[model samples]
Target: MNLDFLLCAIRELKRNKRRTLALFAGYAIAVSLLLVITAVTVFSKVHQTAVIGTTGTHFVTWLPSCGDLSSLTEEELAKLALGIIPEKCKQNCENCTGCNKKPKDILNEGFVINTNTTRLLTIDLANEINKLPGVRNASPFLMFRFRDPTDNKLFTVGGLFLGHLAVETNSCGTNEIIEGQYLSENSFNKVLVDDGYALNNGLKVGSKVIIAEEEFEVIGIAATGADPVKAEFYMLFSEAERVINRRIHNPLENEANIILVESVNGTVHGQVMEDVMKLMKNDSILTSGCYYPASKAIGLNEKLLWVFIVVILVSSILMTVKLQLSFVAERQRDVAILKAIGWSNSSVIKQMLSESFIISAIGCGTGVLISGLLLCVVPVEHLLGIEMSIGSPFNALSMVAVVMFSVFSGVFSGLIPVLFVLKKHPLEVLRRC
Candidate 1:
């Protein structure tokens, strides 16, 4: 471990420049690949998870089975019927006197309607929810179900029902206004349609469109590739309310299908989801479903990191074994002399192990630096399908993992050869030399 001994080892390695270069090069390449893989894996997992959480927030919804117009839970039969029961009535023995049967549970009945009654509550509730801890921002939107006048067919479009809330820039991440201008909260009687939807409907910005009975001026064209159908229409909240008729009871209330909440960070998704579910449960609302970015993507990135580690370990071990064996063969005479002179097996092993350690430190350091440079130049999202932002704590952790793996690999590789050399008999080695 002394400097003189290390210098001697270095000098010896330099004598066989080609062999030294080969070993160093092999180690460097392996370390570089390992580092790159680790960094990319970590970056991808963090990025994709964030994307998924954001997407989940943008699409989160809460639906009530018995769609009473109020946020409060209901227990009475008339309230339940008025809330979600269809306009069509049917006779049932449960509701008749002298009938021993109980009424069918509203929870069991699959009844949902798109109503305008909940438009006011949607905005109020969203604001209230946003004020809670871990809440980022929430906006209320209106969904209208009406037959398109031109086609006379049932169609649904999401309208910004009410509130001064604006689609904050980058709110949808990849989805944004691609052409024309986005609708403002103050703007009224104007609509923004998704690009794909506009194309299908043969519509363009500045065109007049009729929904329900109200006409709106097309103000912008937007694109949300994630959902071709859902992204079809974006309008002012006021416009949405007007189109659905502010006077009408929101049919969708008992069917409360829209309420999206975003958490500040992706890592908080689980916590936020739990809180949301708790709120819903306390309110006696049933959460139909929750979506976050694909967990599969994060899992896949982790698996790839494991695969890379295995590959690096296997390749590094093989190379280290080959190099050590070659060293032992070439220096057999020296090793025998040291043993003959009463040098303990431990000392000799240390010298040989030290040599490998020195080479490994250089190789691994070079590799890590190379990997860092590559990470800087590479568009990680393009490579891994997950966005990577620099300066994240996750990135720092990945770097630490890479460095630790490299040092561990070096020590482990060196130990394997040392063990083999220590088992040889001094006399036998000398006789062969």
Candidate 2:
């Protein structure tokens, strides 16, 4: 009996070709829109994660070269002042007593370590940090201000060993590299120039630039926009040591003032940072986990997109309900005749639902096919400025949910009006018609 009713519903739909097509088109459009939006939302989330991972998933630790004067007692200050005061002390030492001594006195007294523009941390310590649990990678970096021997101009150079993906990517990530290639492990005296700096200096790949009286080959150009950790020139760690050592006339071997640490994941970031803190007392740590204050605009836009999706879904369901109500109204005479012929209310309702289900299944299936094609055609990089395929973001579970929701909306829309019409007797329905 149920099979007969279902077949009857199918025949009725086949006879009402125009009405069936109209309902099919409506459902298909709605489901397609939902699917496209769902795909975009998923891509947006992935883009956000990539952005955060690139900029906010690591931290840098560095030891200050000089101790704070405010933290020192008067006795300690008096002893230090008894020797030669550093040239930098003039601006920071208002409360210190007057003292006059030779510049060599301070170096002979061993008051400060590596006073020639370096704070001094060891590469060995960075290696130790890399061994900590949850620490994805730890890289030693030397940031030096090198004077241009030719022009007598000053330029800041950042030196780091290549081959480590995390820190190397953070400094000059693949996306940021505009020309040439990234630095290799053996690339000594070869430098990566910032795009702006390259332009200003008229430098390009294979161009030679003099730094610390040494000529270096520019191997790549990087466009690091608003990145906090950047320098005019980037070179190998050993090369930078030689540059600084040449200027200072003191060997700076296996020395690094900064250590860049990347955690394996967000869940382990805090523990990794804690362990790092315990390892280095009096060291300053800067975390890159929090989004910059300028990203509030992006956050607002994401919220707006979510709200728009909600509005679209609600309006689509409402429109479907309205269409189904009108469809039920127009078919009341037919429904009355079926009831008069001894079709039970349950049977009638089931047949109508079967029609709704068939239409929705076909509509949703068409919609899914169309959406899949659209995803393949669209490039997410063009839309979001992040390099990724549009089709790759749609998780299997998410797509299943979308299809299920769309079908539910269709069936529920049809059921509402069907129930309303079934409330009346066949005589009442006939009288109304």
> Scored by CA lDDT, what does every candidate get?
0.55, 0.69
- Local error of candidate 2 at residue 100 (angstroms): 27
Best by lDDT: 2
TM for every model, in the order presented, reads 0.61, 0.66
Question: Model 2, range 378-402, lDDT digits (tens) per residue?
Answer: 7545656667654564657666766
What TM-score number comes out for model 1? 0.61
Off by over 4 Å in 2: 41-59, 66-119, 122-137, 143-158, 165-184, 188-234, 239-255, 261-279, 283-290, 294-302, 374-388, 393-399
* Clashes (candidate 1): 14
* Native-referenced Cα lDDT, model 2: 0.69
Q: Superposing all C-alpha atoms, what RMSD in Å does each candidate have to the true structure?
A: 9.2, 7.8
Worst 10 residues of 2 by lDDT: 102-111
- The sequence of per-residue lDDT tens digits that candidate 1 reaches over residues 128-241 is 667767668655545545556467654455654332222342122224678778666676777777686688878897888876567878878877654312535667555654
Model 1: CA > 4 A from native: 15-18, 37-124, 131-137, 142-180, 185-189, 192-216, 221-235, 238-258, 262-278, 281-293, 370-403, 415-425
